[model samples]
Target: TGVASGIAQWENNAFPGDRLDQLDVTNGQVFVQKVDGPVQFFAQLGAYSLPDLGSPYIRSGKATGNFYGAFPQWFVKYAPNDSMSVLAGNLPTLIGAEYTFSFENVNVERGLLWNQENAVNRGVQVNYTTGPLALSFSWNDGFFSNRYSWLWGSATYTINPSNIVAFIGGGSVNTETVSSAVTPLYQNNEQIYNVIYTHTSGPWTLVPYIQYTSVPSDPQLGTAQRASTFGAALLATYALDGGYSVAGRVEYISSTGDANAGAPSLIYGPGSNAWSLTITPTYQKGVFFARGELSYVKATSTTPGFAFGPTGTNTSQTRLLVETGILF
Candidate 1:
């Protein structure tokens, strides 16, 4: 069990105050497992509060959170052995996923490309092992609901073990908006691909990876629609001399154009490109540990434009995020 919190102040971003500042409470969780078995059980719950939590209106809507659920996940796993398994409920998203709760991640925040493209979903997933390869797929409720139908699946393969380790595969995300909450309905989907290379020794490891999102525009928006968007990033981590470790990631994000930019009420951004940086520092000791992270999400402007303002639409908002937590 564990609990922790932090106070983050910012300039020119989202939050409730005379200025951009927020006092937020990060979430917490708990777990219990047997001494030995192919199975274990866990559950998590958290309370997140910040000024100006986005609302169901405005670009991603505008408001404040007495509590913002941080993708809190609960699931059950059955491992017949080490080669195959199945899971249910809110599950672990793969690849870039969300900006938090990544067990092996050292970055305080995730890439904007990841936030705009990859995400954790809830539903059912299967795990399988074949020699040196691992495979997975997911079907869950997506980031949008009611007006849209959602399904997602991803896979990973590990090969070339030695000084150079590698993982390769891809995922496909699908959604359809048939109901009109704001305007003419449409469909959206993407094919995502990523790969990573790593070398490790003792308590240290270094990894670098590349990712891409191929978005196909909606026919409803006509041919002026933007083509697929691709992004690249580099991330590295090192264990230090002070019983601590640090990580940093830089990514350049680009979006062609919204096929659904013409939606009923929601609005997307103006520019086709944006940049994000994530930094994380962590400390650990025996049965207890703590982590701190700072992330900067920026685009070309902050005019408070109301694109993709919910109504069940997808929109990316620029933000400054800081989080600290402890576990025992």
Candidate 2:
């Protein structure tokens, strides 16, 4: 499988390293997977970009080069029976409802809650299913730090045919100091939890989720004080006639601690909070598709030098984006 996509974006309150308008390739990637018998493998290769609300955008070229390289994911799975499987290598994280790539999500950009979750990790995982319950557990490097000191797990329960619920939690067992374009030091050592519910009916799909993350006070880890964030998001999509669909997302996140306590800035600033709304209308025909999105974000109690704009004083931002692509 392969996908190619391009994006044109216009936004206000540009962050320090961001521009007001830009055009770039969003996704040009190939996926290979083999699923049969007792052995299987999956791999994703090439370049891709991750766009999200309330974050500065990175171009596809730099995103691929600086983050996960040309091969973002590659894993081998061994299924010994119908209910048991073991997987190892670079695998996608099970901590969030949204995926890492642009083409795998419902909206053009990810929500605020997605910012606090890990996207991928190198590790070993065990999966098992019995009746209506599916479970998975993994031991991996948190935040791609390559130190392999994190434990993660997820469980999903099917309730009837139209609804499902899932619980996910993960955290680092030891402190990690590695920081890079793909890893944030504080977040790598933090604990995270999520509760998600999904509902589907005739032509509509709805998802609601809540997230919590806590970074403990550890001087050795460079965190002077304990800090945490609580966030909630709702994502919904509706299908219309003639290959048309509409999707929207709403999110709110609030951080704990303040400047007086020297807490790490998890969001806009210590004790700062933010909210965002996004709407995307899409049209698809066969392997071709197009989508336009409008999103707005606002911050409160933001620090003077850590918010938005050229000088980092703006508290609000609005963005317009259009994406066109083909999946083959």
Which candidate leads the pack in lDDT?
A: 2
How does model 2 score by TM-score? Answer: 0.99
lDDT of 1 by residue, 93-149 (tens): 555523434433465344555544434346677788787666776665443232223
For TM-score, the strongest prediction is 2
Error of 1 at 169 (Å): 6.1
Model 1 spans with C-alpha error above 4 angstroms: 13-19, 32-40, 48-71, 97-99, 102-104, 144-155, 159-175, 178-188, 201-204, 219-226, 258-271, 286-323
Worst 10 residues of 1 by lDDT: 57-66
Where in model 2 is the C-alpha error above 4 Å?
A: none
User: For each candidate, what TM-score against the reference?
Assistant: 0.69, 0.99
The deviation in Å at residue 7 for candidate 2 is 0.5
